[model samples]
Target: MDYYDTIILEYHNTILDWVIADKTTPIENLSVLDKGISDHSVITLEKQKPVKRTIACRNLKGLDDRNFASDIKKEAKNIKQLDTGAMLGAFNSNLRAILDNHAHLRTRTVTHRPSAPRMNEQIKEAKQERRKAERTWRKSGLMVHRDIFKTCTFKVKKN
Candidate 1:
């Protein structure tokens, strides 16, 4: 009798299609309540919809062994055989090259990517600037000093 019941009866087929596409089980019975207590009519639909899950992965490639081998061989030749420090340095340099190659493989080759500045160099520059600013502020009269008082308001009063 109400508008909701009329709409449900008219578009029952379309509603069924939406329910089916959403993986909701079809309702056995639909009822319209015309209880005189409430002004608005109540239409009850009984069904359960299944939950859906999605999965995604990043497209990343591993480092090419040929390039890594060539870099290691080139770096290894520069070291003198007799010196232990030179051999260790060469080994460290080769290891760095391999790590750099792997890092390149994980990142995307895009023109819009912004390069990051060296963190240690930036920190050193910031510390230098802070020291310079402090020196300048100390030379100026802006720095203030206050003496502590025994009867300060911040101290709690004893009963």
Candidate 2:
């Protein structure tokens, strides 16, 4: 009976939608909302928990190093006929394919993240102003706009 809100169903004098939790539960801002579609109200609460992020990365532990080296050597011999830029492209593509076959990528979630306090409203506005100035300079191709863009960039960096 921790909920202080009024009953959800006025006619029935009861709360049909509700949450039952122990006192140790880490939640706040619990409330009942009326969405107009259903007679029972919607229960909502905010959990006090850190954010989590997932990132993909190669699993180097399972890599076949010997086969990777041999594949690179074989691909390099076939790229001798290409120009410098094409040779670089072939080398990159071959290397990526070899790595993919050896160390396949895996995604994992990261937890207990710290919020970014430095990237506040002021810093965000400065970065946005810098981008706007850059776009205007590029479109106008004028010296004044270019100077303004440079100044904006300097201001953003200083902050």
Error of model 1, residue 26, in angstroms: 47
lDDT of 2: 0.77
| Candidate 1: regions farther than 4 A off | 1-61, 104-159
Q: In angstroms, how far off is 5's CA in candidate 2? A: 25
What digit string (tens of lDDT, one per residue) describes model 2 on residues 116-143?
A: 6466788799999999999999999999
* lDDT score for residue 7 of model 2: 27
lDDT of each: 0.49, 0.77
RMSD of each: 20.7, 16.0
Name the best candidate (by lDDT).
2
Off by over 4 Å in 2: 1-49, 114-159
Ten consecutive residues with minimal summed lDDT in candidate 1? 145-154
User: TM-scores for all candidates?
Assistant: 0.24, 0.39
lDDT of 1 by residue, 46-71 (tens): 75444444443333355566776777
